[model samples]
Target: MNIAFQDSKDIDKEQVMKLYNDVGWYAYTKDASTLNNALRASLDVISAWDGEELVGLIRVVGDGLTILYIQDILVLNAYQNQGVATQLMEQVMQKYEHVRQKVLLTEEASDVRHFYEKNGFASCDKGSLVAFAKLEG
Candidate 1:
């Protein structure tokens, strides 16, 4: 497969949002305004396209120089494995490797942990990590 990373500059916000929702990564019925806000706020983005089709996408949202918080790494179910995720991750890492610190949050799964670990992420055992979200009203 042709694995390449491109800035999401040309990506259709609506399409991407819908894809995420379709894959259960986001709730159904999202709006373009919210997605635009996210795209604008992203420090950087890397997308994997397969001949005009967006197969995978990942984003880095942070201050753009020092602290980078990796977010929204997803690959289409049909394209899972085959190094598509790894390729996207490689590009994301290369883009932010110069930062002093890089962080990401993933569900507590052995495979997930291993994936992140292979990418040089470590979890904190002494402290707990928590998440809170308030959907748009």
Candidate 2:
């Protein structure tokens, strides 16, 4: 298994589109038309490929200087237990090495939480900054 990382500009849009769609609910999809836009806007994108195939991908969507929000941390089903996600996250974390506050939201998954913890993230309990999202447009 050959593992390599690449940014948005270096990735193939079609492969990323497939990866994003492959992991369905974890990464909800509306339309395929936005894939290009989404990838273009990503602060940093790291993908893990096995030879000529895409096996995993993680995208960071945030302001580069201070806050980095990890968006899509996904690994294809076949590559789940091979440290592909860790490699992708390592690249993302490295890109934000100087960021003071990093945040990300996932679907209350224990495994995901463990992954974040492994990456130096902890549950906020000190009444620091609260997150609020506008549920409706």
Candidate 3:
């Protein structure tokens, strides 16, 4: 499909909401304006486009030097199983190769776990690091 990646937050608001909704990220889509602001404030935002169509997105937030946390990464349901996500991840990893710590949290599914591990991340259980979070849904 000739997916193209843009390393910028210059995406359209409607497209952003749809991309999030396409992957069932209802929480993020609850408020378009708030989400847009979140994207604008991210440490970095990478989007995957297919001929002007938004197919996927990966967003990060962190201090550029010490820690880089991948806040979100999602591909449209129809675009899953292709190399789009892998490429998006590879680009992020490449850009932050020098960052002290890189992190992301995902569902406890086997495939999801494998995806991150395949992209060069180890689980907190496998390392000395432990992660914690408190969220209101």
Candidate 4:
């Protein structure tokens, strides 16, 4: 349970792919090159590693001054309830403390909703805000 945190996207390909697959994010793993490039383009990436294993990650992308979109936050199922995600989030919050708007989009399951709410993110419907997306494959 000795997970270490890092402000890095220096993860090797295999580790990154395995983490995404294990989390059922097959869309990201569908194209390794695209995933790698996206990671590099992120505003910031904070991750948790259990030795050589990619246990958890949180990344943000946006204009650094006015808006930040939390692009992803995933923790291996085995490590889900262990505060790894929380630590990664604390890193994002600390690094972006001056930024005013932080946004995230996720499924509407209760556990998922609770997790984000506990992390200080409010649902758009509950606030004076709205979010929209268009996905193509």
TM, every model: 0.82, 0.84, 0.96, 0.95
Ranking by TM-score: 3, 4, 2, 1
Q: For residues 1-137, what per-residue lDDT tens digits would candidate 1 score against the true structure?
A: 87667886558776677558656765423566767677667887788888877788888888867888887788877788678888878887887778887877767888888888887777764257545545584
Worst 10 residues of 3 by lDDT: 127-136
- RMSD in Å for model 2: 2.3
In candidate 3, what are the lDDT values of residues 1-137, reduced to their tens digit? Answer: 79988999989999998999988889889988899999999999999999989999899999978899999999999999898889999998889889989988888989999999898899998869899988886
Instruction: Order candidates by lDDT, high to low.
Output: 3, 4, 2, 1
| lDDT agreement with native, every candidate | 0.75, 0.76, 0.91, 0.90
List ranges where model 1 is wrong by over 4 Å. 126-137
The predictions' CA RMSDs to the true structure, in order, are 3.1, 2.3, 0.9, 1.0
Q: Which whole-number lDDT from 0 to 100 does residue 19 have in model 4?
A: 85
Clash numbers, per candidate:
0, 0, 0, 0
Best-fitting candidate, scored by TM-score: 3
Cα lDDT tens digits, model 2, 14-65, are 6777777777732344554566678677888777888888888887887889
What is candidate 3's TM-score against the reference?
0.96
lDDT of 4 by residue, 1-137 (tens): 89998888777888888889999999999999999999999988888989978898998999978899999999998999888888988889888889999988888899888888899998988868888988798
Error of 1 at 120 (Å): 1.0
Which candidate has the top score in lDDT? 3
Supply the global lDDT for candidate 2: 0.76
User: Which stretch of 10 consecutive residues in model 2 shows the poorest summed lDDT?
Assistant: 25-34
